[model samples]
Target: MTIRMQPDYRLSIAQIVPRTEAEGPGVRFALWFQGCPLRCPGCCNPEMLPFEGGTPMALGEIVRQMGQGLESHGIEGITLLGGEPLAHAPGAAALARAAREIGLSVMVFTGYTLEEARQMPDTAVAELLAHTDILVDGPYVREQPDSTRRWIGSTNQRVHFLSERYRADDPCWRQPNTLEIRLREGELAVNGFPARSAVGLWRRPPWRTPRDP
Candidate 1:
């Protein structure tokens, strides 16, 4: 008897920012994968914590949108920020591979430290790392803060360059430097904290919109 395995599709998404000045270097297209196990206090996107919160999208559709973002608006690369992307490792890996194939530099944001990720047994996590150029790893510790870090919150967390020093056999990437987190109004409002960066965001009404407003 043969066992047929289903291909891993793209995981559910909380949001997509097609053109964002923040997240990474250059204009980046960011995908916020849904579902997280870590129930960190004051998490910016607490809405993304529940596994069942968001709608699942097809991998091809995501890739297509990314291509459009690159061609039409000149987005330089893609960034994966998540409610724990490693939770849906297969889907994340598939997406990373797709992005790399198109010559888009990839960056990922995770709650897990580089050491913790190395210890995880999931095969897809390894695959995800294979295509990743940079990883901002570790849990958010609000207590430790440096005024100058870029794209991360605390001093304890590290920005690791995977392609430079990471290996499949041996785990643990080098701790490059501290990261900075710039917050938009929605993030601060949701997280219940003050934010450095402010942006105008549209809030959709809970009720259905009438044909004429």
Candidate 2:
């Protein structure tokens, strides 16, 4: 019998939406990494910016969950959102590779431009970029809120279709942005772009507050 080895890499994640249509193309598994070095003003995920808090999960476990999502929800892809995915590039690369191995597409949202990402000193960042099919890059400028592009936060950010899996003129990208709300594991969680007037209307109960891993 062949001996099997478990994946040992772990990632610190602020949130995990197993299946979401608003995160990227089609229903996708969206992961928000816990820490970010860049302090972009008016960041959407302010809670996720600190390096201390998150759920530390093994690569194997995350892969298992991805498989479950694929089987249950038929997710077409995986999207890596942040607290800066490049800050956790090694784990992100590993996850991207795993997703690709299982025939899933990969999308990434990053504060760094394509040029900056290419110049990063870490090879893992490069690896993650290689696995990415679409990358939405540049910092979120609150002043330049993009009302036209679905899923993009600001007008300064650029969308790069690194691979041929998607197209700029795709009708999917032209659709209006939407918010997804779900009662997950007894906690009410919301994802996607929210209307400005409704931004602070709801808050998670105390049990769902951000905590250290």
Candidate 3:
């Protein structure tokens, strides 16, 4: 595959959380890209589904932010989530390369299965996969929601360790589901593979009581 580098690269990003423990192993920076081709049901971030509505950030700005996260928060690596990271393959590949250059491990979550991604004619997709240390692939299946696996939404999603940064034998990957809730400026944001009740609880108004006090 011919790997082409994108000069003056920019990514359509939904959000960038500087530090998060729930995204991957250890403390890590998380980037959620703006668009997705596969609008799978039960997607955790439906806001990321629209291809055109995110901030178009320069690649250098993103790298600089990652470096800041590493320095200020001692982040171990970066996790790329989406809409679908692979949908923006070239830019995603460039970002991953930049992250690796700074000695940070890269993990990616995608709706494309490994086989499907490998067969894509786009060299950018191949290049992005090449730079990924860990990849969680397969579309989210609402019927097969998974709570036992770490960093994946469904049982059908498979985790691939493309490099030595992490291991399949690691207990963290098989542990029961976990989540993190962040309350910022009176807004609540939940992260991780949370169960239905947890989501419901989060959605419930804080002032409301069981007895309607």
Best model per lDDT: 2
Instruction: List lDDT for all candidates, in order.
Output: 0.65, 0.81, 0.77
Is 2 or 3 the stronger prediction by lDDT? 2
What TM-score number comes out for model 2?
Answer: 0.88
Cα lDDT of model 1 by residue, 119-188, tens digit? 8888778888887888988877767653446556667778887875234233222233322232343332
Candidate with more favorable, higher lDDT: 1 or 2: 2
Task: Please give the RMSD to the true structure for each candidate, in Å.
Answer: 7.9, 5.2, 6.8
Q: What is candidate 2's lDDT per residue for 1-213, written digit by digit as tens? A: 111235867788877777778788899988888899887777867777898988788888888888988988899999998789999988898899889989999999999999999999888889889889999999988888888888888899999999888999998898888787766456666778862213521234222432311
lDDT of 2 at 70: 91
lDDT of 2: 0.81
Off by over 4 Å in 2: 1-6, 195-213
lDDT of 3 by residue, 1-213 (tens): 544455456788877767777778888888888889897777767767899888888887778888888888888899998879999988888888888889999999999999999999888899888899999999988889776777667889899999988899987776666577767546675666562213521332221221111
Off by over 4 Å in 1: 1-10, 164-213
Ordered by TM-score, highest first, the candidates read: 2, 3, 1
TM-score of each: 0.75, 0.88, 0.86
How does candidate 1 fare on TM-score? 0.75
> CA lDDT of 172 in candidate 3?
71
